[model samples]
Target: HVVDELALLSANIVEVVHDRLSSNVRAGTTGVTLSLETEDQKHMDKLIQHLKEKSIDFKVLT
Candidate 1:
């Protein structure tokens, strides 16, 4: 459900880069490192804000 929500939030993103090197699954939760690339900075900010609103822990990798 969370992942689907994430997808919806990132619908405007042009591409999503998945960090397979650091992605993994734990006991109950799976960790997914994604870098979203978008032409509009506002869209990026909206996505990040949505993630925060959903209480999803995430780190921006640059």
Candidate 2:
């Protein structure tokens, strides 16, 4: 989620990992996982068409 896109991104971020959890549910890890970087590809194609009109599940490795 990058904390809701970080004021429309001016980032050159690298290797920032995080950890804190409960409710493991056999290690499915129950909710919210994100990694984002934007050096601008037309704002990553309008944030991938606003996450595909809010259907939400996303993956774009480029």
Candidate 3:
């Protein structure tokens, strides 16, 4: 059940990111970079792992 919850959470995060990017584009913001950060690296690790398990590609800039 944890995995399922993670999957849903990850999906929601992706959607929010997508919406932000879309809004930026509509506002003529180009060459914008998006970054995700966590105060605790462990949470970032878990999120990255969940994204990878679902075949999503992401880069950690830290």
> Per-residue lDDT for 3-61 in model 2, tens only?
45433445444444444465543364444445567766897677777767767665666
Candidate lDDT (C-alpha), each: 0.64, 0.57, 0.52
What are the models' TM-scores? 0.55, 0.29, 0.43
Let me know the TM-score candidate 2 reaches against the reference structure: 0.29
Compare the candidates by TM-score and give the number of the best one.
1
In order of listing, the candidates' clash counts read 0, 0, 0
Best by lDDT: 1
The digit string of per-residue lDDT tens for model 1 on 1-62 reads 55676678655434545443443645555555554565477877887788789897788776
lDDT of 1: 0.64
Candidate 2: give its CA RMSD in angstroms. 9.2
Candidate 2, which ten residues in sequence have the lowest lDDT sum? 24-33
TM-score of candidate 3 to 2 decimals:
0.43
Candidate 3, which segments miss by more than 4 Å at Cα? Answer: 1-33
Off by over 4 Å in 1: 12-30
Candidate rank order under lDDT: 1, 2, 3
- Clash pairs, candidate 3, are none
